[model samples]
Each structure stands twice: as C-alpha cells, then as structure tokens.
Target: MTNRLVKHIQNLLPDFTAGEKDLSPFITTRVVKKDEILLRENEPCDALYFVARGCLYLYYEHHAVKQVIHFALENWWITDYKTFAMKGPAVYSIAAMEDSELIVINRQQYEALLNQYPMVALYFNTIHERAYGAALLKQKTYATTTKEDFYKYFKNTYPDILARIPDPIFASYMQVNLEELVQLKQSGVS
Candidate 1:
C-alpha cells in the first residue's frame, strides 16, 4: 500500500520520494464500506483521506436533505480541510459512495510530513491550487448556466464519475430535483 502511495505521488509530482525515509511511518490504510460515514457534522475532522479506490462525497444536511458539495474519486483526496487545519468540528459530512480503500494521514503526521518532505509539500500545494481553481470555475459556470446546461457541464466534465454516482446523489450535487435531473438526463443531453 505504501508503495502504491509512493507510485501515485510520483506520477503526479514526478520523482517524488522521501529518499531513504519510508512514507509508511506517516500513513495508514483503511477499507470503508459503501454508505459508511467517515465524518459527520460537528465531529472533529482529524485526518485527510486519499482514495486508493472507489468514491466518496462531501455534503451538508439541511432539513433532513443532503446537499453534496463535492465528490472524490480514485486517486483524489477528500476532507474538510479547513476543519482539519483549525481542529474544529466539520461543517459537512463525508461518506463512502462505494466500498473504498483509503490512505490516511492524521493531523500530526501531516504536519510532520510537510516539514520532512519538501517534495510532498510542493505536491500538496499544487493539487490544492488546482482543486481551488477548478472549484471557482465550476461555481461561476453553475451560477450562469441553466439547470440543463449545468447538468450538461457536469456530465461533460465528469462522464466517468457521473456514471459512478447514484442519480439521486448526483442530482443533489447539481442542485436539481430528482425528477428534473431525470428529465434532463433522458432528454438526450448526454
């Protein structure tokens, strides 16, 4: 698992390594069952999860309804980063969309890791920037587009992930009602 983690990082960062130092000392692996809640609202978010397989979604529950904010698929990272950094309770919950394998690093090791591995620090910075940029772009696009166009954009942007997510969940993420999402999807917009 550690080797796989190293390989994945190297693929993204190109030659990323800890030299003679092993990453296993700073990381652990866990298997999450589908629908398992990894973190819930008001729970302290103490770690980051790197998806080694399967998918996860981050959402907020309002009036008993789940409004998904984001999805993390294979090779992606997921956590309430602000909460993790602040040592505060999560504003949202994260749940497994499928049985998942995750590489986890808790707050303590994460700080030590950045201090110890410059390359790892740079790698995290790069991914964070990209995610932030993409999120801003998506937010702007979603704000300007119609419900249909928004659905199209999501479908076009994440066809693979789109298929992996359940319709109701994806509908919630799109901020469209289930019936409308069904109509849009079946209306030959794919």
Candidate 2:
C-alpha cells in the first residue's frame, strides 16, 4: 500500500513518535468503484475511512430520496460517528461518487492507538470539532441563505466537488430540486 495514510497522519500530528508512525502500517486500504456503496444504513460502522483519491457521498434516504449530508473528498475522514463509537447500526450510508482509494482504521485499532497515545485522541478530537463546526455552518446556511447565496458559497468552498458530482446529487446536497438546480445554473449565479 502507498504511504498516503502515514503522510496524512504525520501532517495531522507532526510531533508523533516512531511508534506512532508504525501504526499507519496497520491502516487498511480499499478501492471502491464509482456508485458502489461503501457502507449501508443499518449495518455496523466498525471503521472510519480517509479518502486518498476520488470522492464518497454520505447520505440518508427518506422516501427514496437521498439527503446528502457530506461529501468526503481526498484527505477527508468519514464515518458514521454515533454507530462507530457506540456500537450500533449506522444511520447513514456512504457511496462512492467516483472510483476511490480509501485508507481505513477499524474501531479496535483506533481505540488502541488512543490508549497508547493521548495526543492521537486529541488529533481525532480536532477532526470531529471541525466536522461539527461545518455542520453548524451548513445548518446556518440552510436557515439563512438564499438558494443563490448557498450555491455561491458551496461553489467557493468546494469547487472540485462541484465540478465532479452529478447535477442531481449536487442538487440533493443543496436541498434543492433538479429543476431549481438547473435554473440556478442557467442563471449563471456566482
């Protein structure tokens, strides 16, 4: 496997020890083809994944409609937090938006690493904190921003993701219908 996992960890924890570096070897890697579901709702979420390449969509389905919560692009870590931590069925499913390279760390190994290195826990905490902050921001955007404003913000923040994801999926992510998305696109709203 490539050392992308180690490089990401080292980037996150610059002061890590040699032993900590060794832990990266145990991180598993997998390839997911586009549209493949990496995780399904109601299944156990034993692992979290770091996106080495391509993208994954995190979503919940309601009335057969996908409600996109997040997009995991390269360098992003993704997992069903409640299920992964508390041991239960996942509330969301993760599917590959494009052929993807992923590095995975199962719950057991993650807990073991935290036990051996408190700072590793801190690193993960920071990751969670940022995710939480983004979620809050997303909520605020939905509540306060106009559709045009939201689209502009999304484009500014995730130009790569916008370029790659399909129109319907991108519309779902924005909580808008396909027609609305097309109208917005046609309007050339920045």
Best by lDDT: 1
Best model number under TM-score: 1
Cα RMSD (angstroms) for every candidate in the order listed:
1.5, 1.7
CA lDDT, every model vs. true structure: 0.88, 0.86
lDDT of 2 by residue, 1-190 (tens): 3366556656888886545356765477899899999889999999998899989989999999999989888888898988998989999999999999988889887887677767778778878998999999999997799999999888888787799999989999988999999999899888
Q: Which stretches of candidate 1 lie over 4 Å from their true place?
A: 19-21
Query: Which pairs clash in model 2?
Result: none
**Model 1, position 172: C-alpha lDDT score:** 93
Candidate 1's residue-wise lDDT over 53-166, tens digit each?
889999999999999989998878889988998999999899999999998999998988887787898788887998899889989999998988988888898898888999
lDDT of 1 at 142: 91
